[model samples]
Target: MKKEFRSGCPISSALDVIGDKWSLLIIRDMLVKHKKTFKEISDSDEKIAPSILSARLKLLESYKLIFKTKVPDNKKENIYLLTEKGIRLTPIIIEFSLWGNSNMREFNEIDDIEGLNSDKTLIIQTVQDNYNSMLLNFQ
Candidate 1:
């Protein structure tokens, strides 16, 4: 579906595009874990179905949250990279992760997220730098 807003409400607008669990999970994999390829995303612990994963990837791309590009020196392979819009979602994802970790035992904190969150500038810079490094490798 194209960028169809249910109303002028910001929350509903966002939910219309990325309210689904699969969408958020895919975003989480790319943003938090830096998963780039379809295979990498499929290998996540949640084990999402292949068909569903494919659809979510396409949807994210359509929403301009991510874009697909050919892997350098590998014409047959493509990788997903987050767009600036996606990068801006970093804080929201971090907060979401922290909230989940607070209640769930299985979802252990994997990174020093508390420290990252405490220092907003450092976290944003870290995410931007990481993306920049990944982009450099493709060039």
Candidate 2:
């Protein structure tokens, strides 16, 4: 799908595509939670509605962030796998999680990434490594 941006600013353009309510959450479900199929992605804590999930998946696909394929055992069902572009967002995702852990903790519980590493650099490296390994399946 063609996108219409309000401005040429880097942050604005990036947000124009992914700044919606459920876009980043969907990406986080795939990246950090390792959700692949429609069912799996829908089974997130945020409980996104089917209609909104469908639209966001299409938008992500149009942007080449993810690819959809039929499940080997179930052709009727599709598995949504992240592309290189999607995997490249791992660092940003981690940053959001850490920032939320720091700032939003007073309001909400967060920081599952702490299970991987308390050190920021170490956690980013670990998640990036995991994302790369996952990309191998697509390649």
Candidate 3:
């Protein structure tokens, strides 16, 4: 499928790829929660439908944000993992988390909000290390 951009604006171009809420949430799951399978991701706090989860996973893969590979011991099962491009999104997610915590009272109640709200660099590095290590397995 062709990736159709709506305009020349950088923000618009970015939204064209990772614009949807579900897309970002999927990235969050992989980066923050280390969720590697469809079931794990679908069972996230948002509870996304299987059909929607399948489509979003494919879209993320097409955009080079994530990839799916067979489990070394179980060929029948596939695991979704972040690419370098996707790992790069960690900072953005951290920033968003911080912003939400600051402005939204409910956001402040999220699991481990205390840790997520402190020391942005630490959060970014921790997620990057987790994802890069996973990527090494595929490489």
| lDDT scores in order | 0.81, 0.82, 0.85
In candidate 3, the residue pairs with backbone N, CA or C atoms under 3 Å apart (3 or more residues apart, or in different chains) clash, namely none
Arranged by lDDT with the best first, the candidates are: 3, 2, 1
Query: Across residues 1-139, which tens digit of lDDT does each residue of candidate 2 receive?
Result: 7589899899998897788868899988888777889999998888999999999999999999888998777789889988878878777887887777678878876645545447777777777688778756754
The prediction achieving the highest lDDT against the true structure is 3
Q: Give lDDT tens digits, candidate 1, residues 1-139.
A: 4766899999998888789888888888887678999999999988999999998888889989999999888889999989888888777776676666556646664544555435656766776677767767876
Q: Give the Å shift of residue 65 in candidate 3.
A: 0.6
Candidates 2 and 3, the one with greater TM-score = 3
Stretches > 4 Å off in candidate 3:
106-109, 136-139
Q: Model 2 residue 132 lDDT?
A: 71
Q: lDDT tens string, model 3, 1-139?
A: 4478999999998898888899999999888888998989999998889998998999899988888998788899999998888889888898888877677766446454547755789878987997788667765
Model 2 regions more than 4 Å off: none
Q: Can you rank all candidates by TM-score, best first?
A: 3, 2, 1
